[model samples]
Target: MNAIAVRAATPADHPRIVDLLTRSWGETVVVGHGVRYDAAELPALLAERRGRLAGLLTYDIGSEGLEVVSIDAVVRHAGVGTALLNAAAELAWAKGLDRLWLITTNDNIDALRFYQRRGMRIEGVTRGGVDASRRLKPGIPLVGDYGIEMHDEITLEMRRPVGSGIAQPG
Candidate 1:
């Protein structure tokens, strides 16, 4: 495997990111915090390996902190996700942010485990959050991977000082 290269996304990378999000989420509009974000327009970090787009992590940098709107690693278990996440956290710390956060559906046990192992903790859970999101996208499935029912949104947060390289309890 070639070494992974992570970098800030350029305007030319937008459509590819949109394509990835569309393929992964069934749409390019991500509804979160009662707002819909066009994933193609967001700031993102892209991961490249062997001249191929290996992964993407789109995020919102707000006054509070950074929110990971969507993340996809087409090449699974290849350190793509980790590289993108670290790059995002590095950006957050560079921007003087305090923390990073993201939301995953209830059925995404793999996501929960992955984020936790990376030092994130459950900050909140929006019961029936998918119901509200479905109203916006309408493509959200009633069921998800592993045949699990999708019902709620679980919020995960990492409260460590940006670039601390430490995962402390939130």
Candidate 2:
């Protein structure tokens, strides 16, 4: 396999990015932690392999930290997701941000494991949070991966030590 190239997304990538987000998440808008975000409107990173788009990660930078609004790899277990995530972390570190965080549904066991293995820890859980999310995006399914009932939102975070520079992924 060709090495994956990670880079900041340019405006020219918007149409493809919007298509990817729509296909992956059911629409361009994603609801997390009670906020609805049009991921296509956010700054993002793109991962390409062999000159083809392989993955994308959209993020929001705030005074508190950087929030990963969405991440999707077209090919699973191909390092595309990891590369996008690492690039996001590096961007956050460059901006002097101290933490990187994201929200995933409780039913997304795969995501929980993925983030945890990459050095993120569970920061909080909002029980039945998906219920409120449904108000914003009714397409959120009643069930998710592994036949699990979707319910809560799990917030996972990795904190960069003060003045420690970039935090490496585990």
lDDT per residue as tens, model 2, 1-170: 69999999999999999999989988899998889999999999999999899999999998769999999999999898889888888888888888899999999999999999888889899999998999999999999999999999999988886657767432
Model 2, CA-based lDDT:
0.91
Off by over 4 Å in 2: 168-170
lDDT against the true structure, each candidate: 0.85, 0.91
Which is the leading candidate under TM-score? 2
lDDT of 1 by residue, 26-107 (tens): 7788887567898878899999999899999999988768999999999788899988887887787677777889989999
Which pairs, if any, clash in model 1?
A: none
Q: How close is each model in CA RMSD to the real structure?
A: 1.8, 1.5
Candidate 2: pairs in clash: none
TM-scores of the candidates in the order shown: 0.92, 0.95
- C-alpha displacement of 148 in model 2, angstroms? 0.6
